[model samples]
Target: MHKILVVSDTHRKDENFYRVIDIEKDVNLIIHCGDTEGSETQMQQLSTAPMRIVKGNNDFFSNLPDEQEFEVWPHRFFVTHGHRYLVNMGSTDIRREALVRGADVVIYGHTHKPVAAEIDGIYVFNPGSLSYPRQEGRKPSYLILTIDDEGELTYEIKYLELF
Candidate 1:
């Protein structure tokens, strides 16, 4: 199986970043949903796997793309920081954009809340925030996605501390 690590909204804090990197070293792909707060350079150095990072609203100094669409062979993903999509209000904007882009899945981060659900023939996911979480109990978190050779996909949310 091929594994992918997904995280977002670090906001310049990286206490749990290395921990995730160490635990998921077997995974060669990492996706940052943005709001890194100018920590791209450090994240790049510490990442053992190739990383795809977007530009969040807070990433004013960075020139990363606002959104990205890529494939893992048979699986297409739409990734964005979500401000353009108005994620703080809801996922409608993202849903519409994902559909237009012909993506199988949408990965985004903006609300600092962990979300995982399949909506309207598409998969919508948010890894929450690794440094700051706004969901119930407020525990930092991230996500792990695995794709089998047969193209089957599995996902799980791993929190820094048990809620």
Candidate 2:
């Protein structure tokens, strides 16, 4: 089985992000949708697992790509920060882009809102923001994606408890 950690919008704050890295120590891969705010290098080094990170709107000086595509056996993922795709409006634009890219999954962050759903056969996910969450509970959140031996995927959303 392959375990993956999906997180985004840290905005340079490492407290929660680092804590999560420590907690999910067994993750096989780490995917940062975007908005690391220049902490991409440190974030990558925090975990032994290979990381895939993209540039966010707040990352003015970052060198990361605007979008990335990769495959985990039968699943193809499209990763982006969501700003260019107008995520604030809805997922329509990004979904269209992902369809054009031939991806079965789309991971993104920008609205600082967590979303997990299947739309027209495409899996859409967002881990929200660890530094500044805007969801209903306003808790730092992330997604755990697990791919079993048969390539079946399962996902769960986790929230960090803060005092």
Q: Whole-model Cα lDDT per candidate?
A: 0.90, 0.92
What is the Cα root-mean-square deviation between model 2 and the actual structure? 0.8
Which residue segments of model 2 deviate by more than 4 Å?
none
What is the C-alpha local distance difference test score of candidate 1? 0.90
TM-score of each: 0.95, 0.97
- In candidate 1 the C-alpha lDDT for residue 120 amounts to 92
Model 1: residues with Cα > 4 Å off, grouped in runs: none
Worst 10-residue stretch by lDDT in candidate 2?
A: 39-48
Give the per-residue Cα lDDT of candidate 1 at 85.
85
lDDT of 2 by residue, 1-163 (tens): 8999999999988799888988886899999988888889987776669999999999999899999999997899999999999999999999999999999999999999999999999999998988899999899999999999999989998999997
Q: Please count the clashing residue pairs in each candidate, in the order shown.
A: 0, 0
lDDT of 1 at 15: 72
Cα lDDT tens digits for candidate 1, 55-126: 999999998999999998678899999988889888998999999999988999999999888889778889
